[model samples]
Each structure stands twice: as structure tokens, then as C-alpha cells.
Target: MIDSHIHADTRPYEDFEMMAISGIEKAITCAHDPLPMKSAVVTLEHISRLQKLDVKRAQENGIDLYVAAGIHPRAIPTDYEKVINKLPSILNNPKVVAIGEIGLEKGSKEELKIFKEQIKLADKLKVPVIIHTPRKNKEKVIDTILSLLSENLDESLAVIDHIDDKVVDKVVDRECMLGLTIQPGKLTIDKAITILEEYGVDKFMLNSDMSSAPSDPLSVPKTVHKMRLKDFNDSEIAKVSYKNAEKFFKL
Candidate 1:
């Protein structure tokens, strides 16, 4: 199975170890360079350094862990140009699979500007994008993406992530693959199956979205188990847990 999205913040390496033990064969580790926050943002430079370390560790352990680099919408600000300029080298990394976890947030105009710039970079590289949509402005983000798709006609393999029941319909309706983050409080496997039944599993995929707070890297299996309880056929469960992600990541 493939985990579509994951961060390095919460118990980073431990999360992948748990996933390997849970039968996940591969995982894509996403990182964003720190932002110049009132405090400090985890910059892309830092993420690059850490990604190399994670890559080495994964190789040593015989686990397939890939890396993706991008500037998240929340990490954008006035000096975002400097961060944007450094993206080429990041995308060129041999282990980097896609340019992602990039998209709009419910922030100021400056943030939107930066987000658009990153989207352009992903387009230029012809790599897939893992979009992070804000809960409130999902419709707007979808519209923006649709516009880009219309113009490019060759829209990258995009994953519109963090989708919940509220926006699942619209997301699936657009024919964009939806990435459901399985967190204890955020979303339950049972509810995700219900959404799949309502929306169909053709464009659906699952991820742990595990963090340090409290999460399970085994969420993919847990979700599969819930699908079984719902009487969803094995083929359908496979599509959500593995097939969809495999096709998207081109694994």
C-alpha cells in the first residue's frame, strides 16, 4: 500500500517504521521549508537536509520512502520569492516524486500570490501536485484548479487532500482524486467508507496524515477493515487503499 501524504513534524522516522510494520510497502514523505514566522518556519533548506537523512535511513532499512518538496500555502509571506527561487533544485532531487502539498489557504492576499507561484512551478516541472485545500475555501480552490486545468489541458496528477464529508461530493464530482487523511479525531474509517459509498471509490485514496499528537500509521489497514465491515467488496477496498494511489504516483 502507498501512503499519499505525510509530514515530518510528528515522530518523523517512527511513523514510517510503524507503517512498514503495518504492511505499507512505500510512503511519500512531504516537507515544506520553514517560513519566516513570528517565531520561525521550517524552511525548505532544512527540509532538504532532513530529506537526505530520511532517504538514507529508508535505504538502510530497505523501506521505500520517497520525498516531495514544496512551499505550503500557510508558509507564504512577503519574502516568499526567495523560497520560490530555490524550488528547481528541490524538484530535481532523484528521490522526489512530485511537487506538492501545495495549494490555497484562508490567508491574506500575499499568501494566495505565493501559492499561485508554486502552482506554476509544479506545472513547469510537469510533476504531480499534492494540493492542500483550506477547509473553508475548498470551492474557490477547486475553481482555481479547474481554471488551471482548462488552460494547461495537461494538469498534473493532482491530489486534493484533507477532504471531509462536507466537500467530498464536490471534490469527486470534479474528477480529481481525493486524499482522505485518516486521523483519530479528524476522520474515522467508518465515515470514510460511507463517503466512498456515496461518492464512489474510483477517485478515492487514503493516507494516515499521522502527527505527533496521537495517530496510527496503520490507518490504511484500519480503513480497509472498516470497508469490509461495511460489506464493500474486496476489489472496491483495494481500489481505495492501493490501486488509486499506485496509479496516481505511477508506482
Candidate 2:
């Protein structure tokens, strides 16, 4: 199975072992970003090392891990141009697949500007994207994404992660990929099953969204089990659990 999204950088080698044991053969991991107020002095080059180490650690642990690089919402500063400028070199890394976990969390003007810049950067690099919409005003976030994506932007090359029930329908259109986070609090097993049952797993993917918090890395694999129990057939389960992500990440 492939975990479409995860913060594997925040975890240890044992965590990769756990993911492998849970049947997660591959995963897309995000680079660590220093928050705005928290670390305004931190440079992108400093944080980029963490991303390199993440890929190396995953390989050492025998997991097929891909990296996504971006300044996440909570990590964006008032002036992020210097950070964004460093993306081209970071993106040159072979394992880097997408530019993301980028989107509005606070929905501020500066945040939107940075988000737009990264979207364009991803397009210029000809790579896919992984977006992180705010947990509360997700519908607003989706609308913002639709408006910002230029005519040349390939909607099929992006996935909006950490989506909730309220914005599910609005995000499931042909515009972009839809991601379901299997974290304990955000999206439970039952909610995921229901979303797949209703959405029919067309442009959908599942992620653990597991962070340093008390989240489950096995959530996606466990959800696959529950899906079978609920009578979802093999192809249907594979579409959401692995195939969709495999194609989305172009693995």
C-alpha cells in the first residue's frame, strides 16, 4: 500500500518499520518547515537538511519514500521570497515528487501570496502538488485554490489533503485530486468508508497525516481492512488505498 501523505520527518526509524509492517510499501513525506512567529530567523537551507535526512532515513529503513517540499501555511513568514527561492535546488533532489503541504491555514493575505507562488513554482517545475487546506474553513480554502490555479495548471496534478465532510463534495470535482486523512481525530474509519462509498473512489487517496502527535501510522492499512469488511471489493479498495496515490504521485 502507498500512504499518500505523511509527516515521516517527524518520526523515527521505528516508525518506518511500523509503516512497513502495516503494509505501507511507499509514502509521500513532507519537508519540515519552521513556523512564522516561532522561527523567523530560521532559513530554508537549515530546514532543508531535515528533508534530506528524512529521505535517507526512510531508505535506510527500507521504505519507498518520496519527498514534498514547500513552506506550509503555519510555517510561512511575512517575507518568504528567500525561502521560496531556495526551492529549485531542493526540488532537484531525486526523491522530491511534489511542492507542497502548501495552502492557507490562517487565510491571511501574505499566506495566500506565498501559496500562489509555490503553486506556480510547482507548475514551472512540472511536478505535482500536495495542498494543506485549513481544517475549519476548508470550503473557503477549496474556493481559494480553484481561483488561484491558473489556466495552465493541471488540476489532475494536485491533491488537497486533510479534507473534512463539509467540503468533501465541493473538492471531489474534476479540478484536482481529493485526499482523506485517516488521523484519529480528523477522519475516523467510519467517515473514510462512508466517503469512499459515496464518492466511489474516482480521484481519491488516503493518508495517515501522522505527525509528532498521538496519531496512528497504521490508519490507512487498517482502513483498508475495514473497507473489505464493509464489502468494498478489491479494485474499489485499491483505488483509494494505493492505486490513486500511485498514479497521483506518478510512482
Candidate 3:
């Protein structure tokens, strides 16, 4: 199984140990250069330093971990260009899988501009995108992304992460895979099964999105078990747990 999006800040390289015990084969460790925000302030440089440590930890653990570099919406600020310029080298890393965890948020015009620029860079790099959207403005943000992909839609592989029941329809309608975060309070097993039933399980996938928060890495298996209880067939359950994410991440 491949964990689509995970923050290595809090736990660092411990994921490999969890993967070994849980039978998870691979995990994508997302690295975002934290940006200054209006409400919450963190520096991109600090996050970058943390991710560098994460890469080293993964190497030491002997896990086949993939990393991604991006500027998260909440971290976008005026001085983003300095970090954005460094993205090319980051993407060139042999362990880097995609460019992501980047998208719009409820922020000022300046933030939106920076977000759009990163999207453009992702396009130029020709890699898949992992997007995070606000609950209230998910449709709009997704629409904007689709607009950007109008001409070369097939060239891009995109996953809208942290989707709930409310946004499942838009996700299915767009034919984009949905990334369900198993983090408690962020998403529950009940809602995830509902999405599978509604969206046909073909375009849905699971992600731990595990971070500094109190979350169980076991949530992924728990979600699979919940789908089983809901009468979803083995093949259907496999799609959500492994097939979809495997195809997306090319593992």
C-alpha cells in the first residue's frame, strides 16, 4: 500500500517502522516549505530543513520513501519566489515522486497569485499534483484547476486530498481520484464508505495524512475493514486501499 500524503515534520522516519509492522510497502513523504501566514506564521526555510532531515531518516531506515516539494496554501507569502526557484532541483531528486500539497485557500489576492504560480510550475514539470482545498471553496478551486488543465488534461494526474461526503460528487463528476485522509476528526470510516458507494470506488483512494496531530497510522487498515463490513467486495476494497493509489503514484 502507498500512503499518498504525509507530513514528516513531527514523526520524521518512524513511518518505515510503522510500514514494516503494518505491511505497507511505500509511503510518500510530503515536504512543504512553510510560508508566513496571516493567522499562523511558519517559515519555508524551517520546513525545508525538517524535510531534509526526513529524507536522511528515510535513507537510514532503508525504506523506499518518495518525497514531494511544494508551498502549501496556508504557507504562501510574498517572498515565495525564493523557495519556488529551488523547486526545480528538489523535483530532480531521485526520490521525489510528484509536486504537490499545493492549492488555493481562503486568503488574500497575493496568496492566490502565489498559489497559481506554483500550479503553473507543476504543469511545466509534468508531474502529478496533490491538492488541498478548503471545504467551503473546494468546487471553485477544483474548477480553476480543471480550467488550467483544459488543454492537457490527460498529461496531468491530480488527486484532491481530504475529501468528505459533501465534495464527493464534484470529485466523481470531474473523474479525479479522491484522497481520503484517515486522520481522526478529519475523516471517519463511515463517511469514507459512503463515498465509495456513491462514487463507485474506482476513483477513490486512501491517505493517512498523518502528522503532528494525534492520529493512528492504523487508520488505513481500519478504513479497509469498515469497507468490508459495509458489504463492499474484496476487489472493491482493494481498489480503495491499494489499486487506485498504486496506479496514481506509479508504485
Which is the leading candidate under lDDT? 2
What lDDT does model 3 reach?
0.69
Off by over 4 Å in 2: 32-47, 150-152
| Best-to-worst ranking by TM-score | 2, 1, 3
Question: Higher lDDT: candidate 1 or 2?
Answer: 2
Reference-based lDDT, each prediction: 0.70, 0.79, 0.69
Worst 10 residues of 1 by lDDT: 33-42
TM-scores of the models, in the order given: 0.85, 0.91, 0.83
Clashing pairs in 2: none
Q: Encode model 3's per-residue lDDT on 122-165: one tens digit a residue.
A: 76876777877665676677666556555443433777788887
Residue 52 C-alpha lDDT in model 2: 74
Cα lDDT of model 1 by residue, 1-251, tens digit: 77777664444566567677777877777754344532223465556654777766655555577777776776654465666787787767667877677777765566556666776777677777787776677676766756655454245367788788877766576646788888865578877877888878888889887655467778887888778888999888889888888787776
**Which of the two candidates, 1 or 3, achieves a greater TM-score against the reference?**
1
**Evaluation by lDDT, superior candidate among 1 and 3:** 1
